[model samples]
Target chain A: MTDAPPPAPPGRHDRPLAPAGGAQAVSELPVVTTYPLAFTGQAGEYFRIWIVNTALSIVTLGLYLPWARVRQRQYFYGHTWLDGQNFEYTASPVALLRGYLIVGAFFLAYSVTANFDSTLWIAGLIAVLFFGLYPWLVMKSLRFVAASTTYRGLRFRHHGKAGGAYLAYGLANVAAGLTGGLALPWAWFMQRRYQVQNAAYGNAHATFRGDVGDFYVIGLTGLAVGIGGGVLLALPLIALFFLLGGANFPEAGGETFTPGLVAGLVGAYLALLALYAVAWQYVRAATLRSVLNRVEVGGVVRTGATFSPWRLVWIGVSNALVQALTLGLATPWAAVRRARYVVQGVQVRAIASLDDFAADAAPSESALGEAATELLDINLGF
Target chain B: MTLPAPDPLSLSGVFFDGRTSRDRAATLTVSAGEAQLRVDGGLETRWAVTQLRIDPPVPGVRRVLKFPDGSRFETADDASVTALEARTGRNRALGQVRRLETRWWTALGALALTLALAWGFVAYGIPALARGAAKATPRSVLATFDRETVQFLEDGGYLGSSRLSAARQAQLQTEFRRVTAWAGGGYPYRLLLRDGAPEDAPFQLGANAFALPNGTVVMTDQLVALARSDRELLGVLAHETGHVTHRHGLAGVYQGLGLTLLSVAVTGDLISAGTFAAAVPAALLRNGYSRAAETQADEGAGRYLMGTYGTTRPLRDILARLDREDRNADESSVRGGSRTEDLLQTHPGTAQRLRHLRDIEARGR
Candidate 1:
């Protein structure tokens, strides 16, 4: 169980589905039921919503931004279903608008100060201030997002302490800095663990049992592949150029495949891209499997994810290329596809009955923190 | 005794009491203009149809209705929602959104229009607005930026101490002034000379001459050395002066800022970290001015060369040499890493710039 599992071969067990309601097993027997999460969003459907939102937002000079955000969130959440019920996003746009305004005002004041006096000191001061506020903001954002996300009339909740958030974010930052950024994997794991342990679905608190070693494995592999593969990819291009007699050949070089500088350069670019894409895929797949499977809700419901790194990488590279080529018009389709792929890979195992569990919706959190984080360009919850 | 079929259209759904998470089967009865809910025959609630609060339905999802007392009803059944909508009237905004989603052709048209409008704004509207904003800004305000940037460069070791002797500096200054004398004393032009960019270091903004918004031009020692004649150096200075006189530097900054804000406004996607990440490269690659702006600058350089040297030949010659120098130095091996490494040069390619200069000379009397 310590080693990461191999790619799940396609079979009845490969893609998990929820157990049939009528099925029964003996009381003494151990039961492992897999519940498949579903994303039913369609690109064509989302495009209409996006186009209208974009048009209206521009028409109103960005005043419709909050509403647009809410609509988009609602669409995505509403389509994500587990056990015949969907999640709901129930935030008030007016609150988010207020948060944006406050954040805007703060930036305005800072800009004025920066313009009139020494910018370096003022910028440093603002950075320090934001760093101090980071933990609090992350905590608030988590609570707000969790409280607003409803499933079957009950909102998910976060019970994590502010101290924990500070430990996760603040301490991680210091540690990463101290290690000259080499402690990134450890820091990432700690932050993720903190977030996961504090999550609650209905009445059950979540727990994370993942180790930092897994993160390092993925990180080291990514780094190794990035460097080794880059060199290997470049070697062929260089050799080809020398063989082709385009430029002066190396002292010991023998033959050239294609003797043109243009060919060699283009080939080199494509090879490098391939290496990067593959490296990123491996890291992403390994990380997702390690992180998600370790998160257990209510000590009964656990998640499982198994994705083919090569396939995931292919999707990512092609999706980016298509979006760029289309000048972002295909963004809706690409986003939906990516979400669908990730969601489809997830399987939830519940050892106990999930239908009877319940938790009351928490009171709405303040919008000020959420808005301020946005205007500060801090990506907290996405 | 069918009893009018129990209205036949009563809405059935799931009900929550707001105090508890237990879900119960619910039926919504609209009778006598009141919306009544009977839950598992255990709890009953009613509100006037007009007074009931309804959360707009997302397509293919549950519609939630809330009573003033905090209890709520939700159901994914389309028929039930339709019945409720028919009784209380549909939410106009959601209705429009739904219609747009279903009307494929209309959505397609809107998307096309949006893209067209965005392109138009980026290509034409932003530049025009930036020109206006630049003109409106005071020179003193722009000068503050100039001082700060130059100070920052000096502090960072990017601007090394000037290595030219006083006589050589004075000679070059005289030549610059003599070439631009036709502009008279009204143009607030100043010149500064600095060492070449550092070698074997990260920051490699090399062998460059550029203008600040405040009518100040910087020429590097490398650029001076690259010039075979004083006429060539003066030609470069005249070009930098054109940038200052036209306020292109300030306009460029304004255009970049304006486009970023406009992109956010149009997309309404502030939370997408990719939005900002993508913006950085766009700004870097868009550093070059439009063809028209570059042509204007080149013409300005040609005009100066003609006035001072009696021909634009020196400017043309220097441009060709610079083109050759660039070709020799274009050995940077892009490892296909960050997009910033491949950012388009802020000036036109040397060939294009030379062609434009030749065009200017051909048209010059």
Candidate 2:
């Protein structure tokens, strides 16, 4: 069909349940079939869309932003396939436009008031108000995104409560602060649990069996790798700096730019960049694998991901370098490559047929929460 | 809406009833302003063709026809759907957008237009807006901002009591008052001498003078020590006076705010906006803005120096000496300090400033 599908590993999907087709019999063994997620978006195609969107946004003075965002998301979701059916994004742009206008007005007022000394208190008041309502907004955003996304004609739902969100975020912050950020992994674990456990596909609520200890392990390991690698890389660069006569350069009242100094600085910068990329990608890959492997939806489908931390780190660092060298013109290609890698890593193991999942009554959600959260750069990913 | 009766087109696809994930092999036929779906098992459904909600075309992606009551029929037969849409006349504008998106030439044109518009906005639009906003800011607010900034510097240990003799300090303060008076004294100018060489501070202000909003000028003790004569010190005060009179401090703040907002908006997402890729251009643009401000301040100082001393040699000499000191510091520091000076300098080079001052002197003569 559409570009030969990656061959599913034999033993992974070959574990057939008892030949009895009854629901009870299937539930006993649980594992029936594995469906690998696929992303079929092309970089050239997406590049055209990005260019058109940018032009139209500039032409319309950003009034077309909501429409552009919806279109972009639709493209991404529509190309992501699992079990021969693609996902869908069905949020109305008009609804999003309303939210955009409100957020825009709030942003403008806040920025303007914040610039002047006399009006700063008003800005502070607005900040306090925003902070107080952040949990509610996050809850609403989760509900909105879930309701807007559909797969196989069934919408995902979010059942997270505002009070629960407040408790999760508040306690995490307090704990992290009290421990001088040593409890950051615990905070991240809590946040991930809150996000995952409240999500559902159709009527099947998700459950996260991931352990908090795994988060600490990943975090500590990432820290150690980052520091150790940075030092290891720095040692040679330091030697190079001395070898290049950086120390012998004029100590006072002379030209600052020497070939040795430039070379040393550049080398150090690149080394630091490499270390950061490796550490960041290591944590990301490990956390993603841990979470995905432990998540079960409806107790019938178990989801898992396989990503080699080093391989992912390589991809991330190279992607950054490509984007930087291209002055952002390679953004579409980079995005597609990353998406393909991530999607290919995910597998869904289902005990029952995909057709059995039923739709939940869609909850009506205002787009304001999504707009507000996106503007504030808050991550509410499930 | 009325449409001519067109030949019925039959398309085979999978249909979902919206209540569950169950799919049916079905055939869809559109004719006489009505769409009918017949499943292989003989289940039939009908809806007015005008009631159909068709998703805009994405190339190589399946076209989905959303029916009333949340049912949907998805098919890869895009040509058939385009013919059906042509007969129905819906989503015309979105179809055009899709057309534009699929064309190579249009995309190239869009890229060019975006680059031009972005360049124009950064080069001209933002500075104009910042200028207007800075002018609109109230003097009282500026004064409060200056007071808070000075307090912050003191609390952060970046500023300390000057070590200069009381006689020297008074003499310099008198010279600063005279310089401001010579420059028409448009602002309530005040001078503060501070020690800026705290090893623990995040930034060292060696031999530097800065003007805050509200006409407060801070001169470091090192700058005083470096000055060869009171006339050289007076020339430096004249330059700081120019910064105060032109409201460059507030303008610079507003410009920074504008640049941040513009970058966030242009990148269309916070993630890319935060990336190093987007930051470089913003940094370059900010440098351009500050360099322009510095040139303007230099020109203003040159005019005042020419009027009072009949020559800009004093100001030019002090600038050259400061530049030399900066280079010396950079050379001594093994860190390759101010590495971005070539691309991200916030001030015009000392040589350039001297040439401009020389031009002003010739014009005065």
Candidate 3:
């Protein structure tokens, strides 16, 4: 309830600023203040909203999805606080409905065409068109999300060019594919750099100083650990199955499953799932730390994140188990728990006062791209 | 234009002018449906309460009021803001939504409704819809799918050239034609004999028979070898013919598509982990659908065998033999007997299926 800023941490003021790309020295700055972000959304409250939204979506046969999406976004954005002020989502539900309908129509057309023999070529054409326009759609989606988000009345912006998006997404994907996935790390680095460096708060553009080598280190290591650990963990369970005399090798294609075999298979599956969760969390945490920690906005506001990969893995794996056990009833709690951890880990350091950034003249963005990206399961959030 | 304010309700807040991130201490007073903002060491502004947009109140969060000029006021005085908002009478529906969101009983009721609705949709809605979709599908589409599936199977080495003798193939094909004719010739049926147990195939299909959507029946060479009598092979063919007649393959495709869409809609933004969790239910639902299709096909085959041979014993014998072979292949006396395992299985238990066939035969008699 207090409006006063938290006191600077001990010895933080005396610590010199590490020279970043285009960042000025600490001696030239007047003062520095660090504000940690906070998420105040409660699971209990969000559970209610989730239930209402889900029920209404079902009853309306998904017609109310736009409103549900807006409500959900508003709840999350309104509860996230930085420097005692919350973020705002200003997108209209009607705009989102237009986008949803457009995307829905496209999907229906594709599915219908795909099912018919003569019309199959139309489905192929649609796919080709979608792939060709993907970069533009991604750029528009970024701009839409940024233009809709507001903190302290100044909207965020994404000014990444369509050409740049193509280079980051289309070219990078081709390179990764050409290398048989060996260049995946480079692809991720390019995309992250594009996303981070093109982001702006009000009129202040952000910068990314992350290195590509760091991405390779994290990406390859995660893959190795995931696969190696999964095999190691599963071997014993499989061995146990054979040892227990449940080895139904299915000679001559007479397939059969015993209780022991089923148990062993399930155990092996869980082991692999756990290892995958660990690896994915590790990569996500490491990449987030690298990108966010190096981000500087307007050469005045610096951002940093500190996340433990193991903690993320625990949260993710446990959340999945809880969701599976409860048949998705505990989804709200899982989301809130993860969001709270991730959001609170972010720290914003500003050498200047937080009240100086000016707004830009932002053009209104249609939600078609946003809806398309969401349907494709693209994660644009930083 | 300033009139004397009556019954003015005042609260402390911060104001933002929208052009910049600047914030300042301010006092907001609401009276007679008009609101006034007095910024400390700044300008005074006023607006009609109806013209201002107040964000729906979240519990323990400050009320944010948006002005017509893109400026905003944030205040922690929820009570005073709620009092002011009551006069505007806007956002009444949203207010009700917020109320529903905040109450325990309403949320509980909503959860129950969601579960019940999901259950009903899965139980009855999806099957009915799939049946209708299957019926509406053009024959050309079904033929295309059937061709593509067969081509893919052959290309993938899941099916190989039959090693059976030309004489055996001819005899079986002739019998297959006769059976199709007797079954009303509803479709232009084709019988394909293939070696299904390819060494490098992902899964072994030693003795199997399946029907495509366009009445293409594939009988494996191993299945021909396993049959002790021609009547058994004919019975298996009758069962597959039933599948083609009911368009079960097309129905299955529609059902799978419907389930995927439903899961995606239900999971919404829980993309990463939620999708993985949805797979569990999806697999279970698919198994249920497959079991239903199997039962329908069994009934159809039973009727055909009884009408043609004056007994359902051929189909029943073959099915029971296949089940025993599967059980024996496990090298254990106990088969997949647990309830959970039964639920997950694509086919109904042999005992249950055999019992149904007996009941059908008795009714026919």
Candidate 4:
């Protein structure tokens, strides 16, 4: 292959090429073909790690999770490889810590402002602030990663966006929040624009597929499970009804209260529980799906991943329960679930022996090919 | 040689004229031991990456890859790639990555928190706020009263009117003082009048009485035409003094106007331009009298009546008569709703006020 990804092998079986100018003595390149990452570590190990780290983080109020996870990820990905390319895990302890502080500040501000009890004006103001700073954070994050490593001759570069550009997109999503599912388009638009506008590349341009299902699915699932669990959880309220109905409440005027009222209130509680579960499921599904589908790649172009909502929901609910009981300490469980689910439907097609860049699996030599081809092209194209 | 900052350091800038459209700005950094160049570009197209890779490339170490347009990035550790990316970090890969991840999550957290807050507010606070808002109609500034009231004086009196002109105000004040002084305090009379009313002798009212801030009084022409006796008229004049002394006139005006303004402002019920030209009327309506102001005016009138006549009996008699007449008129009339309150309620109405006066009189009697 003089330059460029060598055309697919004439036969179905093809392999990525070695760097041109050949492999120097300074570097003896591996010849073994790498496959996309697959779960090689025992699920229990991951669970243990996730449980321990997440619990500790939660106990610490999410203070050291990022750094802790960095180590954990490094350990996990360092051993795992797909298409000959291993997952690269890195984190700036200060950055992670600072970022958490910033995020926490944001959380506090948001809660307070929302609690202000004034509508329309406050919501609009905060939403604008929320979206305005979004691009800055996105760019900062990208730049940090870009400056962090060189993988297959690639590095993350800083990318910033126009003022309020992302905000407009986000507002579109908020507009979609109104419709039970009808507003999915707006939400998709919001995610798409933000992702596309924020993405950077050393190899290929990244874009968004913008599927409405991503939002609708999340909304419905979160609503369903969260609401459903809430309902079942509150099922004990029925006893309260019997207690009230079986007894009586005295009125201020010295009249006996109706038992039926107690029964009615019990019914209302059950109804509220139902609503809660439905809402929880809806949010869970949609949020996870949306996050999972957003992808950025530098080499070949592929759209995005799609997964069954049911699997995501189950994982989300169990993890969520742990998260709730432990006050989000079990978030890593959710992370694991999400990470696994995210990798589930993703497919990367690179040369068989060459690394598949798209797959989240353990093998990816495609980055090497790009660098080699880049060198060859500079000789000719430029 | 001093090398420039690593290639993948900058996210966006216009360079490399050929691929300007593609955002293919790439920077290279080669370390002493590890020869690597960090590549930052907008596109990682087949030709895009190929051109640079062939440049007798001093094999890359860890490379920080990024695109300007798309936030696409990767770090490759393929010995050569790692060598390249390492230039960007100079062996500090961990720091930058942590920063990046931190930034992303920080942003996510902010967005989530904000949304939650907005959602919570609209859900909980709005209903209560809406209820409060609904209570105050805040329409137009105007006087308001819970109930209509009226009082007729003791003597069978005629409600007299003052001339609307400025000069008439002076004349009426003089006339009242002369009559009462001559009557041996028989009729301690003073008129509390409104401004801008009819100047022709008997002032009339369609909606309300207009007693100005000054002692000069102007009864609505309606009031003037409503009565018969001159003695009764004297009583009416004295009654007007009661109002002036008590400053009930101001209270009446305030109730009629300032309260309405407050009500309108509170309820967001601004003045209706079509019905009343809000500008001047609003100005007129906004002034409210303090309770002390009303009491001061009442005392002034009371002292004049008591000091001059040396008796509160006449004032009491006047109040009782007015109360009966007011009740009869109010009940007997088929007048429109607006005419309902030709009242003397504010300055101790007929019953309690008379009783109070009689008591005061008893103390002196």
Candidate 5:
């Protein structure tokens, strides 16, 4: 594919000085190239891997969990591609087992303490300890995931510190709670900024510049529309209630409500729920687009995505419905569809040839935190 | 010099030097001992065929051939991949997996088999394992669990002081002990009474009577007041003993745990919206075994009650009355049926249980 001319940098570009010794310098014209990212993994292919892994895991009575995890990650990673080179997951099963052992110890201790004490104070202390350690765990888990992954032989790295993670997660969450949840948009922005800014492939660092104002604008607008739609939907019910007057109201602790009134209330509640989910899906899509469009690698390679929220909602709703109907047997196919839709919409623009980037000699990080989270069933989904 | 003769097995493809973003036309020729790559620019490379690693095809992806020294030959051409596969036999494991995945009949067969096996595992395997495990467990361990569970309930306001008088309580306990003696010391049973808190509270366990695996039976004050006679109370306690003996509660716990793990494996990510969607039904189905357990418990109660009263009439009467009371109380909160509540109910419909009791009475006669 022919490269598109890069958009002017506006204000962020810093031009380097030309050579003085008569050597011809490369042109400053930005070379914008969008690398196609594709998910080549198929449900049929993955199913074989899944069935085998599951059978073995069952046969081994969960001892094969580490190997199962590695194989699963490797299958997905090895099929996802950018610029014709697939990403790879390099974490060993042994490392994962070590992580599981550490986590299992903590779980055992907690259960024992809770069982023995059976007191409110001990329960509170356990919850407090979990929250206190959560930020550091998140940071370590991200680092572990990044360190295990590679693209074109170059390792990816996560550079955020635990302190920064605390500010992004713990402090931001507290602020959101204190401000009657008005700070949620700002909290989301900060968290995304922290995650994106710290990610790098070899030496090309990513930058996220999406303003918090954009987050609040979309978030508040979505909330307003949701509330408005719900109220509008309930107008008929409210009208019906008024028309029937107070005497027809259901008596407390009595099953005397008119069937019509009960059905109206239930229907309105279900509609309101559906409306909320649809609105949230839209807000999520718009926010994801805004965040992804602002990411730049090395101040030269920019990435973007186009997401139609309506399409996303349909996909989300249908996936849930189908999965439920099939008793979760359709899960692999649903995952494939979602991944394909999202990946196909992503675009990358770089100012120069991507070949000059060299592999970094970064050491692999421990998968202990990730394994712990996995075992605990705490899905960060990073 | 004239070009070397083209081997009949030579396959044309594109090669990536592993250092640039450029792709060059190349031909891979596998000879007697070596695999050689000849690029368009007269650049030639050779590797021992044994040292070459071939990656399998994924949908919409290039098949890669890796050299020992780290260069790569990537091609979208199916011919090149087949040529390599023909030289080195296809991976047996992957090939088998691929067959099950790609062939329509095989995929269908696999799906059917998987669903059948999963259902059997959930329905029977987990419960059987739990029965074995509960039997193997020491009584001391079960006692500890029971003690801790009761303490938690009391702390959580789920258990309260019984409004029943001490004299009346003693009368009920005396009957319960007598009945157990008849069954040859069936259980080391302890009975606790709970007052019904207000509805909608976390501990709104309305008129419920349940037995723990360790032989502790909790009788709600509402249930005791609802009983017409001491014979009715004896019938309920006898039923609870049946639960303890069968280890139904422990089996239910194991089944629930197994379902959770199985769903996790199916969904991969716990955060998926589908995870909760799928979990609710599976949990309900697992608890659906409660219907069977209730039947077993009822039959046990019937045998004892018939021996004492010469009829299962008292036990059946109490069950029918309690079922009516529960329906009225539940419907008072919201008129008509809730689909979720109907789906999630662990116990058999009270009508169904009463019918089974009638059947037992019929057979005994």
Candidate 6:
């Protein structure tokens, strides 16, 4: 005899609710956002945390750099607010570590194989081979991370498919290349779109860009040279030593000097330094202006612009020199500069009025201290 | 007669699920005698529409009509057709409602399978292969490739190679140990130095070096002499050792095997065992990997330099120098016999590698 059919499993069989995709916008249920449906807490707050971490990184002369990025991303996302509430961040350290290890392992193997093999053509062929699938792999990895996020009364969603901001950014990059850097501002805009597209706060989209005053009138490279050169010039003894050579030694008779060599060195150094200063000014101006461009926000769109790289580059160079001279001490200035750069760029498209809306005592106030939809989960156990 | 105004259109019918869709129009031909609808949609398709039945508001006279595009419309003028014709769509293939005929269970199962394969290779394949090479190969046959390749062989060729003598192998082991100690107290490391015939001048034609499983690194004399400078030598060695510490060699074969299989699955083109056999020897004649892999290796190499030497700039210098050599030789014909084909290799561009190393260094410790 045929066995009777088993009953549908509980909860598993219940149909998942379709996305809130009807033409008519649905009014969300009234639940004070103890957590915003976001991966970060607040726009300004995200910047602050990133800045602090980035600063520390700069002090280390890039040694602590990766960690700084990780920390900034983690903190901003972990404590994000969702619809006035905090969303849960769920990325595990282990997952990130595993990814690093596996990818690292592959990287090494390829090196050896390539080293032993003489057919150099295979290198390009293989990269081309993987190029076709890179988008798919990125999509998979991104989606996995996204699916792991949660927000106020809604799970976070990822649109890491063959569409949207990625395409725009790609086009902008091509434009930038074609325009010989003239299209940087437009490219910067595309980058803003890419960043904010993933940001969500109670279904309200948020975005950002470099501030109007943030860009450097000079190019980023130019600005770097200017600040770096100016700082170097300020230290007479240091400048003289570098101008002569990094080898600073006690002088015989209060000042031992070689006229021709010293004069020639000084002349060449000043010439190069002067050129660098001029270029730095332009680059610095351009970079700041580029970052100061506005951040745009809308439903399904949220991101920010930042001009901090020029500051970062200048800080790093100065700090690197300081380390070179002092044997790695007194690097806080560099770190601070680095931190500020990243912080300025870290935007959170949260519910625009979140902090203001959280005027009354509410659970979401706890969320203000957190980020949205990333790794940290407020009340995750529940 | 002016074609009776086409009847008002309605998207009332259920649509079919299709996989292969194209944004194009097509013609359909049907024959009653054959009782078949021939859809000339310029694409092969399969479709499905289950339980297609229509109940009319009222019974009506049936009608048949024809259109000028050489088409016909057959239906009751007063009644609607409750027909489910596998949901017709032009230039679209209806994905057969499938029970996920997937080896995704197979693909998801791949990780475990790969781990198993990796273990097998470690436990059996590597030793067997090593033994085979050592047995069939002569230790005295040091320079494996033609002498013309020496300049390009970065490091010189293998030392005398009837097969590495037990004594020489022991000595090689000692040197590897020293380099290993330099890298760190104890990291995953191995050294495989294929000592070449000293006859291969300047750059050993048989030169090559790579890290193997669990810290095994192989280097040929060709690689050593090929480095025009001491720093370049150090850079090359450090880069290889970097692979050793990272266990790149082992991971690579594992990954390559997976990718090659995937490539074959997607494109039914198969490389014969003979092709691989030929390819291996030919590939061994040069030092290169797929561009993506090379980039990864460069990064790994850079990291190793950064971590071990606490400086990575030298690597950038070395790569740039080598790339210059490669590029200049071809352009100036300074070297008579350099292979033009090698320039078109799939390995990451030399400039790109140098840039990668620089970027890595800039990323900091």
Candidate maximizing lDDT:
3
Q: Provide the lowest-lDDT 10-residue window in model 4 chain A.
A: A373-382
lDDT of 1 by residue, A8-88 (tens): 211113333445663663355447767777777778778777777776666576677788778888988887777655678
| lDDT per residue (tens digit) for residues A1-382 in model 3 | 1222223221122334456764655566466778888887889889989898889889999888887888888878877888777788888888888988887777778877887667889999998988998888888888889899998889999898999999988999899999998998998899889888898999999999888998999898899888889788867776787677454464625436766667767777777777887898788877887788889999999998876766876898899889878878899999999888888888889888788999988889888889888876776635
Per-residue alpha-carbon lDDT of candidate 6 for residues B282-349, written as tens digits (9 for 90 to 100): 34322333344456657766766777667666666655545554422321222222344444465555
Candidate 2 ranges beyond 4 A from true positions: A1-31, A100-134, A180-186, A234-270, B1-4, B7-9, B150-186, B191-207, B218-238, B266-281, B306-310, B325-342
- How does each model score on TM-score? 0.78, 0.84, 0.85, 0.36, 0.80, 0.32
RMSD of 6: 24.7
Model 4 C-alpha lDDT per residue in residues B270-361, reported as the tens digit of each score: 22321222343333332212323333433444545565566555444434444454523422222222221313123323344544554555
Q: What lDDT tens digits, residue by residue, belong to model 1 across residues B1-365?
A: 22443353477777876655566789987765678789996788778878788787565556788888777887656556655665556676766666665567877777777777777777788888989998898877778868887887777778786688899999988877775565443556677888757654347555678778786778888788777788878888888777777778778777766665664553333344235446654565366444456667788888888766777666666666665564233212111223333245555665566666667667776
Candidate 5 RMSD to the real structure: 7.1
Looking at candidate 6, what is the lDDT of residue A4?
A: 16
User: Every model's DockQ, to 2 decimals?
Assistant: 0.27, 0.37, 0.36, 0.01, 0.20, 0.01
Candidate 4 wrongly placed segments (more than 4 Å): A1-36, A41-66, A72-81, A99-135, A138-153, A156-160, A163-170, A173-184, A196-201, A211-299, A303-306, A323-334, A350-382, B1-365
For every model in order, what is the number of clashing pairs?
4, 0, 0, 160, 0, 150
Of the pair 1 and 3, which is ahead by lDDT?
Answer: 3
Docking class of 3: acceptable
Q: What is the C-alpha lDDT of each candidate?
A: 0.71, 0.81, 0.82, 0.41, 0.70, 0.40
Clashing pairs in 2: none
Evaluation by lDDT, superior candidate among 4 and 5: 5
**How accurate locally is residue A206 in candidate 3, as Cα lDDT from 0 to 100?**
94
lDDT (Cα, tens digit) per residue for candidate 4, span A146-238: 444322323333343544434534455456666655776455546445545455444345555555565655555555666566667566665
Q: Candidate 6: misplaced stretches above 4 Å? A: A1-88, A93-98, A117-119, A130-160, A163-175, A178-185, A207-293, A296-382, B1-365
TM-score of chain B of 6: 0.41
Question: Which 10 consecutive positions of candidate 6 chain B have the poorest summed lDDT?
Answer: B93-102
lDDT of candidate 2 over A1-382, digit per residue (tens): 1222224311223445466857555345445688888888889888988888878988898889888888888878888888777889988889888988887787778887986567899889888888788778887888889889988788899898988888777678678999997998888798788888999988889999997899999999999998999888878877877776666665735656676687778778867877887887888888888899999999888998886767777777888789778767887888888888888888998878777988887778889989887776776533
**Lowest lDDT block of 10, candidate 5 chain B:** B327-336
